[model samples]
Target: MRGYAIRKAMQPHRLTLKVWAVAGSFFGSLCFVLFQGGKLALMLFVIVSILSIYLLLGKWSGIRKTAGSRQLMNAEHETTIEAGSSLNVSMHLQIPGIWPIPYVFVKERLFHKNNTEYTYEVTLVPDWKRRGIFEYKTHPLRRGFYTFGKTECVTEDIFGLFEHTGYIELPQQVAVLPQIVPIREWHQFHQMMKGTNHHSTTTRAVRETTQINGVREYIYGDRLSRIHWNATAKTGTWKSKEFERESLPKTFVVLDRHSQGYTEDEQFELAVSVCASLFHYGASRSFALGLVSGGAASQFFEPKHGQQHLKAVTQHLIGVEADGTYPLRRILKEYVQNVAPGSFVTVISPEHGESMLAVLHWLKQLQLNPCHIFVSADPQRKEHWLKSLKSAGFVGYAVSSLAELPVMLGGRS
Candidate 1:
């Protein structure tokens, strides 16, 4: 039994050498023997070695009993939490052992799920009993999925000679959801424009321009593709195809997540806030809503109405960053091609670049009503962009902050 205990206790350990203790003890014992003769030296050596060995054996037994026990955790934990919230995890350990660990210390290590960031390590002094239910709390700052990985319950023998670490697997996941903001502007704008509620059929099933109902005389802004070339040539008059809606219409919020799109982090965060607000508003009304964001990987959520779909989208948005491998125009054009015409496309961008210009031009060609919103840090620049957009026959809104969004879109700014 002693041999087995020693082997188990000797598995793996960290040494915290107490230099002062060693040096003092060694010299004191040496001097005692030098002054008091061979008897004192012989007695001191035997007593010290015996006591150290006994302590090692005791530690071996304690750890072997604790680590070798199979059933440790008794309950599961919450797998999700909102950002800026604390998560409390409760765990019960039933290790059949002595009540008190006289001269040993227990330790626990906290780490991120990915193990990329080292959180902290806590040491528990030898207590009356360390075996019981434990409550751990974590405050993760970033909005993303995180988890508690491994808990190392370590114990060091008396005199800090050796420290044995026994790992207890703690597999718990927590998904930190993104911050949601309420959208006061969208509904307020709806009440003013078209003079109807946003939830009404007019806004819900808005007419689509892709479904052609008939052909009519071409207008000045009609694209060549929309012109009936053969008919126009035969009649010597400009004839254009007219398109209408066949299915349910929805609102699609496209966020420009390109690195150069936003002026800074604040602008990008505001864009995300706007998306989240729209998501909440649209989901609550059961309105089919879609989102298109440009980043390292394009995220395109098809228009759908449900709580489940909203959850999935929120999870994606929580980790979404303003880092795009492709131009915002590419992502916009891709989703726009499949979107229903007459559907509201709310384009949120801070920078007015050529890519954005191309998307607007494409939307115009398709006869899709695109509402371009330019979030500006400079008032002068915002007016200039608005003028350029209006001159090109597009509806645009310029706002210094998100608070002014509703008023500007309502034509009441």
Candidate 2:
């Protein structure tokens, strides 16, 4: 691809060389005709001059009209996918006129939020119908929002003396969401907040209300009062009444997006993955889950339990960037009031400095059970930060990768 780009960049110089060669041939033919006085030399000079003029002007006479003509180009791909998943992109181009194009060069550009870019070049030989399709599969893409820039189609004259380029607006967007590690249970949530004033449980097993939502097969520990006699009589098996339990206290996953905290983009990505895993965990168990990011543009999703809510939060995570100018402490200080008392706030960040410790203390003072998930690349540094957080009377977990998150949170793979 690099070589292709280099060759493409030098195409104009190639054209210039072709023009000079044609001019030199024309002058040499003229000199041969003047000095040698041969019929072949006169014929060669006439042919060279006419060919050069046609190549320079006549070949490109209708190029502007061809380019201005409506050309349709569309790119299709999976708009959303989990991180580390490959994406397949299909592009189709329809040229308006049958200008006898030998082939077309298609250049596709994928741009990330951080100004990172990936370029793909493919050659398409238009059929008799003046349409072509090109398909390519990308490598596993990281978690981020990616947009396709305009697709550039370049076609050269049959003689390869001149190039005409046209751009088709693709406007295709793909979002690679942060990967979610399956977590069976988050024991830290239960163990760390055991004696908290607000009732907090790992799952939605809080005190059941009298309103029966449905009935299901009887579990061993179901209370006698919860027996569904009607369901049992109809199904000829033990049945239990399922009640609409009171909503659990909201769990807010605070994603630390301060630019200064992360040494590498991967660390920030790890933090985002942790947050996404927690959201998945909450959604699966019907917990009121929310996301809070204090980045360049602060985002807050109110605690809610539904697929729609999860989708909205996931969309936000897809495009979220670590562009926060303020530290976590200051950002949270401004947004802390939005959180209710007795709520669970899990701060996911790579920073474990005094500033983070201060944020934890502040949250504790506000009656919020604060937990820290420290993301770092260095093992020794992660261990040290975890110890410091533990010593400060905070429940902290260290995670280096998505695979380790389940185990660190007291869940299996």
Candidate 3:
């Protein structure tokens, strides 16, 4: 591990000892020739040249050691911002000794899940206070989690003949929440219980205990009574009692792309946010959830509940894209045929008219209401779509941004 660390730490710079060796030799030879070819003068010149090379090597080595030993004050710092909101991350770096150097380049290494890397650079100015904070702000272009690790600081010696760099091995993490969340539990409660008091339609077909989800592989800490003997013998492992109705009401969210008219990024982001909100809501109610997306890169996950499925779906959702070349009807028909019967289907899109009508028929065939949640880039157009859905026997809500999603999920009236 240490060897790997050293190589990675050194790989950034194009290091060559040959340059310094040549410089040392050149200075030594010049001094000898200029000093009347005297033996004592030549010896002195050689000694001085050697000392200069040694000093430069020592400085570089010291910087390397300092960097390897340095520690970041915070192991992990979390700052939550609604998607598109600006977020600032501050970090403090401390070293045992201060070099009286004025100019040093500090950089942070970022790793994104989209297989992309980001490097952030800052110039460090000497402060008499000995401690300084570096603040970085980004208008989180995408939601989900982003991580930063292995920071490097580069500085050259005053002579510019040798360069020294330091590495800060700190793990920094930041999470960008979905820009909007549709249908908060609190909002749903108000919608169901407000005024005349209508019951939630999400109730289960079976009146079983809400605590049981389903049988799952047992872990070390699980209780023995939770074990399922029949499943254990069949699977050759301990199977624990799982809850069935512990999750929120089951939701099957579908994306309609035929006429939504979105840029690649906008469509992808909307799909990701919709999936995340459903996962979050399902986890809260212990409800099984599934996702389906239209377009060329079609996807579908069968209705299931658990932390693992949530993570699995989330990873796929981040990269979901719409080819936008195929007819929306094809995707809708596919969703209708593949969706589990009786699961609540929610279609998300800005498109209406034919696409909505097609989705409606599909949902009706499955005997599901299939709520429509339209995320409109334009506020007026979103309102128009909401009214249109209401007239068509489907409840609709408009989300202008991803941030409003959590408000909707939290059950805001």
Candidate 4:
């Protein structure tokens, strides 16, 4: 809360200046009376001196409100910053009046957890524009959120006889991002990848491969092994099967939401960390990766590749809002038509049973091999949950602790 105390035209020293001038005049008048010959001349001089003082006082009092009422202009809050990076604050102040205030002083109060205030002052020079912008950029030495307290502006009277302090309630907040620790080698991810490969291998030969998903007239170079005998016999023409080249797989990552899965803040950080790491991994491996958040609106990013795509995915993850009640199945169902068959998909969540089963069902429909990474705040439940994922056609890896993420993704990407 901010309070403003305006001492408008309240001159505490007006009497002092007036008293000094009166005393001078009285003494001069008395001296002229004693001198006799020059009495009238000295009296005239005293009268002139009194008029000069009155004019001086009028000149001093002439300062009207030079600027408008001073108030906080705007405040900005940001979530991400380097650990030691600066939080730049640009304050807008409205001062009224034509009074020529020589200078305006702005004091920024930064409040700490201990209830201590760190003050920094800057002098704003007056411009013809009347409005002043005081800008300051200071590095946050410590991590966590810091609140910018009220700002005080002090201005002095034209005669410098008194000082006025006005407070502006410009509260601001900023969060410093933790330093990024990259994953070194993707060994753990490689292990999970191996499991997916193993699961996919068994089902590979069960489905017949075809190009353009249909039979075509056999060409001269067509291999005898590819002849679609049933189709050829029905049409009375030689038809051969054509299979698509073994292209890179498209991977869609679905993040699960559950109210009691973890604390709200923890889920947010974990989601960002995992998304960034996975996007980096997929980009390096030339896999088309998509990200979907489970919620009412069903936010989805279609599978894409390259640096721009990775950035887009990571940005979405950073901005992802958690709504724990939304079912993971709902999002998968919305994208079912868009998801290609046989594409490798991965789902991450702390949820088990229904949530895990939803991902498996989506995979079944797409004919995709899927991996599940269950993130739990509880350490003891990690392995048990991972094992449960394996039973559900997903090779699950659990994140028991937050710090283990860098190692889990294998080192720097």
Q: Which scores greater on lDDT, model 2 or model 3?
A: 2
**Total backbone collisions for each predicted model:** 3, 0, 34, 21
Top candidate by TM-score: 2
Encode model 2's per-residue lDDT on 185-271: one tens digit a residue: 687785544545345444324555777777766756567888999889999999888677575566788999999888888888888
Cα lDDT listed for each candidate = 0.63, 0.78, 0.61, 0.60
Residue 266 Cα positional deviation in candidate 1, in Å, after optimal superposition: 5.4
**Order of candidate numbers by TM-score, starting with the best:** 2, 1, 3, 4
Q: State how far residue 400 of model 1 sits from its true place (Å).
A: 7.8
How far residue 370's Cα lies from its native spot in candidate 2, in Å, is: 1.1
TM-score of each: 0.65, 0.76, 0.59, 0.51
Give the lowest summed-lDDT range of ten residues in model 2.
Answer: 67-76
User: How many backbone clashes can be found in candidate 1?
Assistant: 3
lDDT of 3: 0.61
Q: By TM-score, how accurate is candidate 4? A: 0.51
State the local distance difference test value for candidate 4.
Answer: 0.60
lDDT of 1 by residue, 188-254 (tens): 3343334322445463224445666565666455567788888788899888775654445567889
The best candidate by lDDT is 2
Residue range 104-143, candidate 3, lDDT tens digits: 6778777765657877788765456434556776545466
TM-score result, candidate 3: 0.59
Candidate 4 regions exceeding 4 Å error are 1-180, 187-246, 257-262, 361-366, 391-393, 400-402, 410-413
